[model samples]
Target: MSIWWSLHLRRDAASVPLARRLLLGTMETAGVDPDVSYDLSVALSEACANAVEHGGDTPDGPSEAYRVTAYLDGEKCRIEVTDSGPGFPATRDRPSIRPARTDAEHGRGLCLIQELADHVHIGNKPGRGGAVVSFDKILKWREDAPLMAV
Candidate 1:
């Protein structure tokens, strides 16, 4: 069975939980294991929060939006979050994920997403003016769950 969904949301704080709840509901309906679903939800939340906080045009310009897409196929799931802010720093400018200093209050979203997802890809949107963070995970279903429809 395969299912997919996409959301175009304003780059606002409220949109974060909206995306998370929808993902959670979809995973639950598909009988994904609770632990897997929880991990994915946390990763999704981090991605969305990043978009809301950093993925936008200049503050004086028009409000911008972000995109979230999720695909569920059999025992695998993939999710992508795209934001309209300045794309991620150039490849050479990105630093490896590391534990933030104890006094730091930020810089952990990407690291958290990386830890939670099995595979992650971050880069600019091809030919577009935004950044994209994509990830996938192998899903585990409940033993008694019914087969999901494609």
Candidate 2:
């Protein structure tokens, strides 16, 4: 099935809930298990949040415009949040793994995204025009339980 709706909005706490409701409903209609819904929601939220914070649109503050595109194919659902800015920061200068310290009030979104999704990828446009963060989650494929001897 394809995405029912694709929305673009400003990056903010308010946007998070709206995105969650839409994704949850879409996943359920597509047959996603309830037990794993929260996981998917958390992961997607983190990805979007990261885009909100890192996506250069918010040069001074939260960028008023950011693109959020959701798509579903087969048993997997994917989302790509992009920003109109220079792609990922150079690896040497990028520190998305962890914040400066535990007490730091910022960071950790990428870490959450890594834990929530089956695959996460960050790439830059061919001309370094913008950045794209793709998130993919397996909604229906789970490892089979162990068999017991009869």
Candidate 3:
């Protein structure tokens, strides 16, 4: 896995899919397993959507210029996405799944992120414009779980 990495891009609702793909590619390039890369894509997408829907309207504020950065150490991977809007502490109250129902596109992103990431943190960005979602992939797993030995 790569020891260092980063990505920055403008925030536009239309760019959400692109943002996800970019993050996925970055993780893959860093030698992450494909399933792990896909998980990061989904997590970043959910976090970005929150920034867009709830953060400020300024450029880079969710609907504005959104930036996502990801990196890996020997045992873990982490991602941080920044947007222009500001928010209070985030709750993992990401909504539940209803896979059989169509037209139910509004929620479910954070919920998925929360489930996949070994650890997740949400907070306001250090600067004036936005917030960040911090996620980590742990080095170890439950006894019966599959291993990501890469």
Candidate 4:
């Protein structure tokens, strides 16, 4: 069986943990391995944090909300976080992951997401204005997993 969920969340710091908890709960209930769940949860938090911090028309004027979607099917789990911000720069339609400076406290979220997930896609929301960060990872099931695919 496959499980999926989506949330329209406020672009606030508190919303980040809510999304992570939901993902972790879904993974645990579906019998995903603990390590896999941890990776996904961390990645989700980073994506959500980015949506809260940089997801806005102006740097100081952040968007009011963002969306987070998750899907667990067969042997993989996919998660996407989108925000109604100005979106990535036009020159780089698909922004490349760049390492954060050693002294920087921020800018590490995107890189962390890339490290955790098997595949990631970062781009803008076509006609509408927003940023989209989606990622997926191959799941590992526990020995006695109830929802493991046959």
Global lDDT of each model? 0.86, 0.67, 0.66, 0.92
**Can you give the lDDT of residue 37 in candidate 4?**
100
The runs of at least 3 residues in candidate 4 whose Cα sits more than 4 Å from the true structure, single-residue gaps closed, are: 58-62
Error of 3 at 39 (Å): 1.3
lDDT of 4 by residue, 1-150 (tens): 799999999989999999999999998888999999999999999999999988877555757999999999899999999999998887634788899999998899889999999999999887767999999999999998999966
Best by TM-score: 4
Query: Least lDDT summed over 10 consecutive residues: which range in candidate 4?
Result: 54-63
Q: Candidate 2 or 4, higher TM-score?
A: 4
True-vs-predicted CA distance for residue 69, candidate 1, Å:
0.3
lDDT per residue, candidate 3, 1-150, as tens digits?
345556566555776787787776655555566777777778878887776677656554335466777766666888887767765445575323333335676666666778889887766666563677788885442234333344
- The TM-score of candidate 2 is 0.74
Q: Supply the TM-score for candidate 1.
A: 0.90
Q: Once superposed on the true structure, which residue ranges of model 1 sit more than 4 Å away at CA?
A: 58-63, 92-95, 148-150
- Please identify which of the two predictions, 1 or 3, would achieve the higher TM-score against the true structure: 1
1-150, model 2: which lDDT tens digit per residue?
A: 454457887766678778888888776665666656678788778767766666664244434656777776666678887766555766664325543368877777777777778887776655635677777887663244121111
Ranking by TM-score: 4, 1, 2, 3
lDDT per residue for candidate 1 within 2-44, as digits (tens), equals: 8899999999899999999999999888888889999999999
Q: Deviation in angstroms for 29 in model 2?
A: 2.1
For TM-score, candidate 1 versus 4, the one ahead is 4
